[model samples]
Target: MKSMAPTRKLYQEIKDIVLLSDHRSSMAFEVSDEVLSTYVPVAVYWIFSGIYGLLGYLEGCRLHPKGAEEEENVASKLQVLRGVLLQQVVQIAVVTLMMKVVGDEGMAPQQPSFLVCACQFLIAMVVLDLWQYFGHRYMHVNKFLYKHIHSKHHALVVPYAWGSLYNHPLEGLLLDTIGGSLAFLLSPA
Candidate 1:
């Protein structure tokens, strides 16, 4: 009989290869100067939105202390802080991948107008959302896995932007990997 250990190892190796390939393909598509320019404004919006969102939440908590539990507020704030840091890491990875894939190539196409960009962004967002939902469900179903990896995320009952970042490093990695892979795979030919 074929050894189960060898089979498992082989499966893992294949999974890694698929993940790397997906990442490479996505990076290649994203590396154009045009893509960078497009991505930058979106990134900036994300940052400002986070800041404003947190500020609003805090103000609300202060104005309506009875509506917000102290412990939940503290946990939400901590989660948001952690999320910002994690977002930075993700941005770096995305930029690095873009640089690698776009090397020496001319800037991405400037024409085809806003419609194309909008469609692309919409598709990417849809794929990412689906991936996150399914991946989160997977993490929850496995008790041992959930306790060790995803428990940190659930620590905040009242979530904030930072609550997104309050997860185990492994869980963070898994979420990103899954989302990225799905996005790449679902990209138009």
Candidate 2:
């Protein structure tokens, strides 16, 4: 142990310098992949949205320069976000239901090479976009859906990145959740 101490110190130093890491982690990957996968997307989505929101703030809201009444913007965004979150909960429930009903055979493990995985992801992205685009178009054309299911998304006269996700629960679910899940389902193997 004593003989290896110097080598360990050198390795730590290299990690700190070359990797730009100053802290050492005593923890391991103790969480199950399923647990991680379930929560990571929500966490990542909010975080990325926050960063983009911050950038928009810093850049003087160039993306959507129009200003709304403070109460209207805040309350509208809050209400929409609440509904969006609820839709995420429902999506999770739906996925759980499907898993129980259909079984896990569809998600059989894969040992694909990087190239194959990349190709699958590219195709999945295309499918996701198509689904969302068609769904969104449908919502716009349907008068009832436009008034009830998608009007919230159009509340903002002009939308910044932060406002991109401000929408009715059903609209968000139809476009974001379904599109994303379709992509995952298509490439899950």
Candidate 3:
């Protein structure tokens, strides 16, 4: 019985992290602790991407300065950045919703071998790459689809760091949300 105490405590701690506490609110959206926790890594991505993109831009524009003709105006870049931020908000919402749906069903760690975990991660990435390639290819081939959904992304004549997520909602959900969901779904956590 003494051995069960530590395992039980660990489970309880995980339960505290995964469970949703606020389902009722008058606001359009509420940022709960669970949501905030998930947002941290994504926020880090944006920060690092922005920094790298800024450096790249400065290098290209200052040192080499080749594509000045095609370089977009600051206003246009800001507009695209706004769109990226909006889509990130959508992503956060989708993640929160998925968490609510998946609940605590498979949160337990299986303590799989390093090789097994690496293999699962690799397989998941390959699947995601294939889906994204096909999904991206299809969106471009269909003009109507591109004009409606994918054009926003292409508007960035020369994209910056935050430009990574300037896609429209349709493309965003199909590419980002679905691909990521597939990876997590395939992995045993």
Best by lDDT: 3
Candidate 3 per-residue lDDT, tens place, 4-85, comes to 9888867665555556333332322446445675698688978898677667656554433556425653337668767777
Ranking by TM-score: 3, 2, 1
Q: Evaluate all candidate structures by whole-model CA lDDT and list the values in order.
A: 0.63, 0.68, 0.72
Q: Against the true structure, whose TM-score is highest?
A: 3
Writing each residue's lDDT as its tens digit, candidate 2 over 1-189 gives: 358888888788666665655364333224534555567877877788788767766547455444543424534556656765786687676665645664555554657889888988998989998998899899989999998877777776544444556677767677887787778778755
Tens digit per residue, CA lDDT, model 1, 1-189: 667998886776666666755434322333545466536754775787578566755655333443454456545565556665675576557655754664445544445557776777788889988878888999999999888877777776655533445677677766764466456546542
What TM-score against the true fold does each predicted structure earn?
0.58, 0.67, 0.68
Candidate 2 residue-wise lDDT at 185: 79
Model 2: how far is 164 from its true place, Å? 2.9
